[model samples]
Target: MKLLQRYILGELIRVFGLLVVVLTIMLVFVGLFREATERGLGPVQILQIMPFVVPSMLPFTIPATLLLSVCVVYGRISADLEVIAAKAAGISAMRMLAPAFLFGTVLAVASFGLTNYAIPWAVANIERIVTQAVEDIFIDMLRTQHLVSEPSRGYSITVHDVQNRTLIDATFRFRTHDHHQITVRAEAARIHFDLERQQIELKLRNATYSNPGADSFGDWDGTVLHLPLPPQIHATKARHLTVADLTEKTKEAVLQDEIGQIQQANEAAMLMLTGDFHQFGGKEYSQLKGANAEAVRNQRRFKTEIHSRVAMAFSCLFFTLVGGPFSMLQARRQFITSFIMCFLPILLIYYPVMFLMVNLCKSGTLDPTWSMWVPNGILLIAGAMTLRKVMQH
Candidate 1:
């Protein structure tokens, strides 16, 4: 039994490794090309960022890769009559499948770790690195070019030229937060980087700034313009937060919601006691407006995200449960055919269903606790039926 387990486990591991490498490389190049074109990233920059990018891709690839590996390895083994020999020697099919089950359990744990910790960390770092690279390019352009236009940043600047540390015929068009346009034309400007404060200060000589809609413009001599660059490492997106972080955030949200409910109830009681029934409307309780509504929505998303992570992690086990029995039934078929048979449905049915569930979960149409596990539940039932057939045969 030990030897049989070792043999099966070794084969699965070897096949899994090969599949992971191939899939990871394919995904890496896809990402590399996309990022290179989008960010105008040089080969050196892409190479620098590649390591960080792979971790994010691995979680997506691992479960599918595991499914394929299980199919190929187990299908080939069963095709060669290895399972028949084991059964002839008084071994049950479950005993032969023990290693596969163990492998799936380990991967399930690993997937959880990857989803909760590694992917979030990688994504946050990628954002930080990309933002810093853009900032560096902006700084370089400011130092060398007479004119610089960054469409993404919504800024256009033109100068007669730069000599020593001074600019001439400098005009800058900046978009304000309120969607108003601010155009500043200066006779001369001095560009200074405040290293201590991490700010860029443009000291304008004989400048005027005007709103496009306004008839009149304000003029100043030797006006100092200071703009602070974003810090190198911005806060990670709430969705990218770890499970522990999300748990605390979820608790706070729940508390706030409970408090709001209590307050609303108290207010309703007061209104009723004071005979102000007109003040409360049917729509009032159902309608969550402003920050309160936003907070509730965000809490739902956070809860959903956390549940989805856990659900995704366990997909390793679910896929294995489904794949092992499936491969055994198709044991006599060609390995490639068996692989395709196992892989296609996962791509077609499982992924689409999983995506739909996730969207529903995020939109608050479905509860995450139940909705996230629907695909797994279906797979589990299917796997059980297949396992029964395999054992009987």
Candidate 2:
């Protein structure tokens, strides 16, 4: 029994290692290409981001790779009469499947670690690389075109020439936060990226600023302009946050909501005491309502992220649970065919249902703690039934 378990575990590991490498390499390239196309990353930036991209892709690739490995190993074994031989030796099929279960459990833990820790680290490094690349891209564009406009960011710059890192005869046009159109002309300027603040700083020499609408102009020897960073560099999305951060943020949001509710109540009581009932619909009240709504939305987002991360990680175990028995039942078929047969329904049903649940949870329509596990529950039942069949037949 010990030897049989060792043999099964060895075969599973070999197949899984091979499959995961192939799949991860394929996915890493796809990730690199997508990032390059979106961010205009050159060859050097792509190579720099490759290592960080791998960890981010692993959580996505592990479960499917494990399922295929199980299918290949178990399907081939059952087809070759190994299960029958084990049965004749008084070894139950369930006993023979113990190694798969153990392997799945390990992979599930690893998947969770990848998602909760490695991914956040990877995303940070990737963003750092992309930010530096963007700086280079920005300078390159100015060097070639002598003009760069970001309508979405409400800014544009035109330069007479870019000499190395310096801009000669640069004119900057942008909208202020208050919707004021301002233009600045400079004899020379240098740009620096402040990543911690998510802003770009322009150090201008002999600069003159004018408000076109007001027809106002002023001159200064040295002027500094700060512009918000590009949207892609600002990654506040829940997926980029670690589990501890999510939990901390969720708690903070809930506390803010509670405090806001208390303040609203107190303010309403004060207004009623002063007989200013009309103030209930004032701008302050409306702003409070908006803040409360945003807090609630943030809470939902954090909770959904926490639940979905765990659910996605545990999918490794569930995939093995379902695919192992299912493949054994389809042993007469080719291993690839068996793998396709097992993974097709998962692709079609499990993922769609899981995505629907995640969306619903994010919108506050359902509690994610249980809703995110619905797909896993379905797999558990399917695996149980399939294992029963394998045991009896």
Candidate 3:
């Protein structure tokens, strides 16, 4: 029976590792293939960028592998009457799988760390690389003297002829957001693309800028002003930024229970009594007392994020205990059924808790801590019930 346990754990780990590799190749190729058409970078460039993209995906892939590995390996054992044989020999089915569940716990712990730390860093860099690639492509196009688009800010011109290190004929189109009409037509009497400063200088024989937001355009047909380009025009997109970067940038919006706040208040006010909002600290008191809605909401959101992380880590232990008695039923041994049963229950636990927590924060009914433990609590109760039944049998 001990050997059987070893055998099962080995087989499952092998399967899990193989799946991770296969999934990586498939996903990376798909990502590259899709992006290739629009970016038009050469193969060498794609290869260079693949390393940065792959690591971030592992956190998502690993959890899925853990779930399926337990299911398939345990399910098959039950199908073969192996559970009955083990039981007859005084080996409890649940007892036999103590090892596999432990592995799951380890994977979950690692995943939590990755989610918080490693993935965030990779995500931050992903954008920078992609941005550099796009800039390279645009620069390459400029060499052919094509009319390259400058990210809706204006048109771009490539210089092929120059006198005294000054550009000969450089003019980019400038337009309002509608883009239907060209707002500026300037042939640079002279131009210099400054690499050091990362900007293009257009010494326009004539230039014009249409101020669209003001519904006005100042008179100018022949002048070039050095305009500062958007630094991130060559920037990598959102995916490249790490979680910390995201947290730093958008934490303000996320906090404040902004999205569902109005809805929650409306629902609660219908039954909870409207004036209670004033007693807790009216909107006016919030200002004088420095107790604003945004701060409260932000605190709730942060707490929610913390609890959510803890609950996910706790899942590793929950899943392991589950695999134990499930093995006893011999029901857990079927590859197909076991995988489905194990994975589905987990998803059910995870998503609902997430959903409820978000709502609780919005509804003002749950603090972050209580909302997070809901999912773990449900899973623990379910596992306990199953374990009790299996041990009795």
Candidate ranking (TM-score, best to worst): 2, 1, 3
Q: 33-78, model 2: which lDDT tens digit per residue? A: 9988887788998999999999999999999999999999999999
After TM-score superposition, the amount by which residue 23's alpha carbon in candidate 3 deviates from its true location, in angstroms, is 3.7
Give per-residue CA lDDT, model 1, range 1-393, as digits (tens): 488889999999999999999999999899888877876776777887899888778888889899888898889989999888989999888988888889998998998898788878877666656665765665557567767775655667788777655777888887766767789999988876554355557899999998876655899678987655434424456657799999898888878777777767776888799998986765554443333566687788789889888888899898988889889888954767877887787789888999899889878899999999998887899889989998999
Q: Relative to the unseen true structure, what is the C-alpha lDDT of residue 156 in candidate 1, on a scale of 0 to 100?
A: 76
On TM-score, the leading prediction is 2
Window of ten residues with lowest summed lDDT in model 2: 228-237
Segments of candidate 3 deviating more than 4 angstroms = 1-8, 30-45, 85-94, 150-310, 330-333, 345-349, 352-366
Model 1 score (lDDT): 0.80
lDDT of 3 at 8: 77
Error of 2 at 244 (Å): 1.6
With candidate 2 superimposed using the best TM-score fit, by how many Å does residue 39's alpha carbon deviate from the native? 1.8
Root-mean-square deviation of every model: 6.3, 3.1, 9.3
TM-score, candidate number 1: 0.76
Candidate 2 vs candidate 3: the lDDT winner is 2
Per-candidate total of colliding backbone pairs: 0, 0, 19
Name the runs in model 1 displaced over 4 angstroms.
146-239, 248-290
